[model samples]
Target chain A: MTDDIQSRLDSIAPLIVDGSPHAVALGLSLKALTPGRAVMGARYDESLIGDPDTGTLHGGVVTALLDHACGMAAFAGFGAKDTPATLDLRIDYLRPAKPGLDVTAEASCLKSHGLVAFVRATAHDGDPDDPVAIAQAAFMITKASKLAQERARRAYTEGRME
Target chain B: MSQVLIETLMSAPYVARFGVRLERKGNELTGVLPFADHLVGNPLIPALHGGAVGAFLEIVASASLLASQPLQRLPKPIDVAIDYLRPARAQDVYARAVVARSGRRVANVRVEAWQNRIDAPVATLHGHFLITPGQDDTAAD
Candidate 1:
């Protein structure tokens, strides 16, 4: 059963990221996905630098990367059907990301019950042991999100979205 | 001096890309995030991306810190907690930050982002940032 869900997530992961305009703007790509885990990547771009003097990527980049990865994990945890909205997110910046190095986020859904899912994630430039940031988030399947999901499904079926 | 600071803050590569602008009067600063197609996260609901809203909050927090005092460089975020109170609609968003406390090393900030109504904020953020106080020109030498 889990394997089936994993495959389903794998098939839709690329489309999910592609459909998000901000994700596309930042050039995010899904690296891996499973039942309750997700790995995503954001390549280094000079245009995203925060401090010109240090050439370090902005903390916001890490924030967005972790949020998306955590959201993906929550989505998979909810059986990859329900569209969950983020309730809250907390992020800690462990260190600055080096210039010209891509950043990757690995997230796992710790628990899911009722309409809420909890997720934790870490962002690293290269070495997993040395993380750039850590994030914890809660996602809830709201009425609005469910309606939005239905609308998206209809759009997809109608060939409005590619 | 304040105008120059606001200009410097908006000129950052990422902030410029988002078209974030700061309006400063005296020591107060307010952030404006204009609507753009690329800022959409969920096209179905047509809501602004949560990540974009979060980033904007952080930018406003840092801007408040810069406006409150003389800083050697932009403040570095230590950690941030953000709560999504409501879905940000696809339109212009505004934000204001309050520096709760500032010392030699760290500053605590709280920010609120609202769309049409100021009473109803779409999101709120609380964060801590590392800061470096600027030295006087004579002291620098």
Candidate 2:
């Protein structure tokens, strides 16, 4: 049963990136995944620059990345089959990310008590020690597998969107 | 002054991607995130992505900070915290920001976004921004 559940999660986990419109548009990719962890990445794109003067990537992009990473972590924490809804996310921008390198976020599920799950994540360009931003978040885990499959079907089959 | 700030913010490519419109009446301002197919996160729930919602609220907070002061350049984000109250439906979303405090170097702001009714908010964001003082505050006014 454990092996079966793990295999199912492995099959469905890719949907987090492939099924998301905003994530795809942002060029987010899932680089790493585990039972209770996920690492997502987005390379620097000139189109995402908010400050035309400085060419700095917009803070909103960072927020979106962190939020998605945390949610992924929570989802994985609940056996990777349960969907996690973000309850709260806090981010601290330690510094402006360099415009040239790819940015990646690594998130871990700190704990899941009852219906709520706690998560922490950090965004870095290359070096984990020098992180661009750090995030702490919480998510609500419920019937994720059914909801995720339904959304995927809606986007792929119905073509309305996912 | 707010008009100038709105124009500056709306011109940014990132903010323009969401087609966010700014409506201001004095200090109180509202940000509008229109409905679009690209904004959906979960098609099963037919809801807006949490990242989209978070980005929208953050943009509102940044815009509010820009409009509240007379800074020559856009303020940089220091940190932000967001609380999701409910699943955001795939529809037009609106947000309002309040400048809690504005110091010489930093400013704190709070933002709330709602759909369907203003009384209920789908998400809330509280954040701090780094401010650059203008050469002359009087001329900015």
Candidate 3:
């Protein structure tokens, strides 16, 4: 956490993601964090296996892992008070992750424009060169409901222009 | 789809963690995710974790595929594209998968997850899965 970035992030509140229950449930841990980047880790657990024949980690586990990591990056990038919400996410799976190996995901905010922040992430069990899956996502920088309410209130005050 | 396979999917380790239930009413099948405290992402808003909900939909998609074919191995997710239409409130969620097409090697599925109303979905997932269909020799053992 750099001073310039920390100063900006200070107002963001105790990161909306730290120690989240699903992350806790998945045993996801924050390995590293910077201004607009984050790395998370999750150890392979048999209980999370999706393919019994292959003993491969479930795709859902990878989805949650990558999603959280992406959110972390977006939150860190936005450095705002409100929580970031996923507007949409797209993941491309390259191959099945090796069983019994710990998985690590690295995510970074690609760009932030207006109310949306774009992020990308990759999950790899060992080598970064070969990723298990790749994720690209956009997250709303502010709580969506607040934005909707604000728009509605403005509409109410200004009268329905449309 | 075989009843035994359906039971197997519902009992799978990963799917079981979310307490996902699969039920069939005549020709229809549904997936349910019972609400639990651990599934909450933002305690401030108390919203359900997007990842949790996303994962639930993936399982539902997989289960739906399994119900239609006698695949030799569990289908592996190739990719998923999800759109969060609304914030998932804290409550039991229901999801159903519609198989757009099932090809020789791949299957396309569309999944919708909703809480209160079926038409108003919190999120929807579209994905392709690699299906390896064959006999389950292990079942004999």
Which candidate's TM-score is highest?
Answer: 1
Provide chain B TM-scores across all predictions: 0.91, 0.90, 0.91
Ranking by TM-score: 1, 2, 3
Give the better candidate number (1 or 3) by TM-score.
1
- The CAPRI-style docking tier of model 1 reads medium
Residues A1-104 of candidate 3: C-alpha lDDT, one tens digit per residue: 46767665543323334537777788888877677887888899998887676788888889888988898888777753334789998999899899899999
Model 1 clashing-pair count: 0
lDDT of 2 by residue, B42-61 (tens): 76667788888988988888
B2-36 per-residue lDDT for model 3 (tens digits): 45666666677887887988887755779999999
* RMSD (CA, angstroms), candidate 3: 6.9
> Candidate 1, residues A21-89: lDDT per residue as tens digits?
999998889999898899999999988988777888888888888988998999999988887999999
lDDT of 1 by residue, B1-141 (tens): 233444566787888998998887766789999999888888888888888999999999988887777777788999999999999999999999999999999999999999999999999999999998774323322
- The candidate with the higher DockQ, 2 or 3, is 2
Off by over 4 Å in 1: B1-6, B135-141
What DockQ does predicted model 3 obtain? 0.42
Candidate 3: lDDT over CA atoms? 0.81
**Real interface contacts reproduced by model 3, as a fraction:** 0.68
Question: What TM-score does model 1 achieve against the real structure?
Answer: 0.95
Q: Each candidate: what lDDT?
A: 0.89, 0.83, 0.81
